[model samples]
Every structure is written in structure tokens, then in C-alpha cells.
Target: MSANKGFETKVPENEGMDSGYMSGLVSELASGPLSEPISEVGSDSGKRISVSVEEEQLDSGLDLQISEQLSNLSFKDVTPTTQPLLVDLEEHKPSIIPQLDRLFMQDDDGDTQLHIASVHGCQKSVSTLIKVCPQRAWMDVSNDYGHTALHLAVLSGHDVVTRMLVLAGASLDVRDVSGRTPLHLAVEARDERCIKSLVIPSPNTPREKMVRILNMRDYTGQTCVHYAARAGRFDIIHLLVNCGADILAGEGLAGWTALHMAARAGDAALARAILDKYGAAAAARDFAGRSPRRLAARTAAAPAFAAHRRDDTDTDSDSEDDYDSESDEQESLFEKLVQLNNPINVV
Candidate 1:
């Protein structure tokens, strides 16, 4: 075997040597056989290593070749020490396009960049951001309708988004600038799915005391049922009625009832349905003194005609005879006044 070699290391006296004689003796012994050989060394001192550009390029090429060869090698051929390093490098490779699509699509807005992520359909992103950076999401998130993500999802008929927001402990009754609720938006959009999703039972309350919390009125004092009436949507009307809408609830400029609205709209079937189910007591009287019946009469004359027909035959014929006798008496009095005007005719 080659003799063990150690390079002589020198320390300046100013560097502080605590054991001068022992260190020097040890250094002398280390330079002889029995010392470990040094493979490579480096120093902070300004020293240049002689290397040509061609030699540097060749070394770089050799390193690249070795890396490529290692990459091509199977896991079975890799050493245990290098397996974890290769795994880390492989794990850092960019995800596939479809995987990225799925990731972004899982969020509502389908945005990969963090800055552009807060958008209307991006319910997942909005929810995630609500936990991650609530202030930013609250301040910056807006949808296509110039509404915040909450408003957009609520108004655009996305119940899932609404529920996600609510579950994340967002405010339930927050109104948009228009002073409309998510319920109002659901009604306006005629989305029963969203409406059903919002009908939550009260927590730890008596069943009788658990009043229907949703389908409340907007700033216009118009409930969801009122919107259904105005739209002539009987299915929505039925839904609202079943869900506890008061048929007698008055709203709008004229404070019209659902029955009155149905009448005014000339929706005879809907009017009849409301009247038969809720009773005529629910009919409203507008400022014009027109009740549901009166308004209905304007559009449908059958009821009015029937009413007149019932009264027409009840008049007494003797009343007409008495009126004729009275007219005869008035004619004689008129003739007397005429005679007084002409004295010769009177004689």
C-alpha cells in the first residue's frame, strides 16, 4: 500500500496556538506513515486553480453525461443513498395538463395564478381563501355582474356556493346593494333547487316555534311569493304557498294581495285557485276601490253578467204601473199651469 501522507499545515503565531510543542510534534508524526491521505482541499485564501475553457467544458459535459446515465437507470440499479434524492427530483417535476385542469377546475374560477383566483364560480377558491386570506377575498373578489362572489353565486342560482359560504360561517342575511337576499335572488331566478337548499331547520327550537326563516321580503316589501305572482309562475306560487307564504300578505305600490295580483294579471285559473284555497277574505282592495272581484270583472264579465241576471227578474211590475199613474197626474198639473198662462182659453 502507498504510504499514508498528510500535508503539513502551518498556523501563524497570531492565530493563537495553545499547545505549541505537542501540536508541532503531532504534525511531524502526521506527515509520516500512519496518517490519512487527503483527496481534495480548499481554502478561503485568494488562490486560482489552473483550468482551460476546453477542460471546463469537458468536465461539464462529463457531469451531464453521468446525470443522464443515472436518470436512465432503474430504481433497482440505484443505490439506497441516491434513491431518496432521485425521488425528490422526480417529485418536483411539473404536474400534467389534465391534472392542472382538474386542480383549477375544482376551484370555481379555474384560475392557476393566485392573484386571479378570486372570482364568482370559484367557490372552492373563495372558500379556501376565506380561511387562508379572508381580508383579501372580502375586499377583492367580484363576479361578472359587478357583485361580490357571494352575491354572484346567490343571484346566479348556485346553491352549493351559497351553502359553502354559509357553512364557512358567512353572514346569512347579507344583502347586496339592491337590498335583496339570497332568497330573493333565488325567487327572482325561479331556482327551486337553491331555495330548497336554504330551508334549514332552526337549532334546538320547538317545532311549533320554528317559523320559516327564508322567503322573506326584500326592500320592496315583496316576498318571494309576490315575485312568483308577478311572474305568473303558478308552480313557484304553489311552492311558496306550501313553504308558508301568507296568501293575504300585501306588497308593492298598491299593496296588492296574491289574489289581487292574479286577478289583475287576468290569470283566471290562478285567481280561482287562490280564492278557492285561501278564501275571498284574502282579496285586497286597491286605492281605486277595486277588489279582486271588481278587477276580475273588468277582465272577465261572466261573474258581473251573472250578478245582473240574478237581479233583473226580481223587480215588481206594479212599480211600473204606479210610475205611469204618477206621470198622468203630472200631465194634468202641467195643463192647468198652461191654462193660467192663457185666460181666454181658461173661460
Candidate 2:
């Protein structure tokens, strides 16, 4: 019989209200006067109820529901399994690129910074030295065997680092104290990339300079091409020839040519290629007076040496032609010398 008797509804314990009633209560609360006393009531059935309190509780419950829905909406589909949402997080990680050290850290045998860089693949450090301390990068930088930075890079097969050093104005023609250039290092390492990169002409260097570098003799007088042949790098021999490296060039106390080295290394293909393209002049005598064919004949490549017999015959013809020209020049020179020495005979 009370004013709210018919509206008496059991509010279940630990149970939430229906959505319609919750919405109506929220609307009533928004429109009603402020400062109204909030209270709770209980039905005879022991179901707890409150006029204003139910509305507030329902609003709080609705707020919680809305908050949950909003949270679900904001969640990404690709949420990570670990950790809560955070804007930023600090993480420990190793660097992808290598860090470089000082160029000249003193070690047992005075190993240079360039030496370390080459052995460890420290391109960054090598590059830094080239840019910041070029003089230090160049000064007395050698490995235990007296190889230079170019030598080390060549030995290590670090083509990019080698190119960087060359472009940074590293002396392409500078030999180790042993007189071996980077090209010689490439041959020793049998690295075609280093050889190719080193042989290619740079903007600042002329073709003649490149050729001179290729022909540069080490302390042993072995040219870069000779080393390539010795290392059994046939491709390099071809590359050198195409670049105009003298086919007949030799060095060392033994004066070995590229062909001689190839023959000694038992590289029949390289020897044949050299003879075929550049002619038998390439296989001519070294300081030991042994032609590449003779060296090959002594090796397991005797068949290759025999194959070049016809070429050697042609080479003999060329030699005869050269001797004739030289003999004519000698006669002309002798006549001039006699005329200069005995002017009274003309009178």
C-alpha cells in the first residue's frame, strides 16, 4: 500500500539489475533535484533495496560495464602475450653494426689498428680512421708479416672495406715493407673480389697508374699479376691482361712473369689463356732464364707446355724480328759514335 509498493522488486544479492531499469534510473538521477537524501530499503522477503542508492549503484555498475566495453574496444588484435600496455619501454640489445676501436692500440708485436681492423672485420673503425686520422691510418700500419691495411683486407676478403680504403685515398701503389701492394695481397688471399676492386681504375688514378700498381714489384720483385698466377687465380690473370698489365713483366731475383708463376703453380688453363691472348711473349724468360713453357714442361702440365709449341715457334719468329730491329739500331748507334769520335777522318 505504500507509494512504491507496486514498484517493489526483489534486488537479488550479488546480482546486477537489467539494462532498461538501469538506464531509467540514470535518466531520473540526471533530471532530479540535487542534495536529495540517498537511502536503502528492504522488502519483507529480505531482498535489499534503496530508492536513490539503487540508482547510484546501478550508475556505478553501468559505468563499470561501459568502462569494460571501452577497454575491450581499445585493445588491439595483435596484442603481445607478455606485459601490460605501455607507451615506451627500455630494452637491452646488442648492436647490429660493429663498433670500431682506436687505430693504433699497442699490442705485443706493434700490430697496427689497420691490422686489427682487417683481422676482426672492423669496417667501421677502419672507415673512421680513414676519415678522421688518415695519416695515422697510413703510418707504418702493418701486420706481423709486415702486410699493410690493404694487404690485411685482401687477406681477410673484406672487399667493401678494401674499396673504402682505396677510395679514401689509401695508396694503391704503396707496398708493404716487403714491397707487396694490396693487389699482391689479393693474389695471396686468392680473393677475386679484392683483386677486381683493386684493379678497377679510380677517378683520381689514371690507367697508367693502375697498370703501374699491377706491375709493382714486392721486395721479392714479384708483380701483382705474378702473385695472382702463383695463387692459381686464372680469372685475375685474365683481368690483369685485359687491364693492359705487361704480359712479359717479371720481377724478383728469379724474374718470374705471371705466366711463369702460373706454370709453376701448375695452372695449365691460366698458362694457356695467357699465351693464347697475349701471345708467347708472356711466357718468355724470367731472371732465371726459364720460359713459362719450360717451367710447365717440368711440372705436371707438360701436356699444356707441348700444346704451346706452335705458339713458341711464332714467338721465335717475333724474337728474330726484334733481334733484327735491335741489330739495325746498334749499327746506327755505332756509326754515329765513330763519326763523333773521329771527325778528322771526314777532313
lDDT (tens digit, per residue) of candidate 2 on 183-279:
8777777777676656655543457787777777766556767677666766777777777676687754456677766766677777777767777
RMSD of each: 33.3, 32.5
Q: What value does the lDDT take at residue 263 in candidate 2?
A: 69
- lDDT value, residue 156 of candidate 1: 47
Given candidate 1, what's the lDDT at residue 61? 15
- Output the number of the TM-score-best candidate: 2
Instruction: Return the top candidate by lDDT.
Output: 2
Clash tally, candidates in order: 3, 3
In candidate 1, stretches whose alpha carbon ends up further than 4 angstroms from where it belongs are 1-119, 133-148, 202-215, 280-282, 287-289, 300-347
Q: Per-residue lDDT tens digits of candidate 1, residues 157-275?
A: 55555544433334335455445665667677787665654433222211222133344566556677777777777777776666566667776445667766676567766666665
> TM-score for model 1?
0.45
lDDT of each: 0.41, 0.51
TM-scores of all predicted structures = 0.45, 0.53
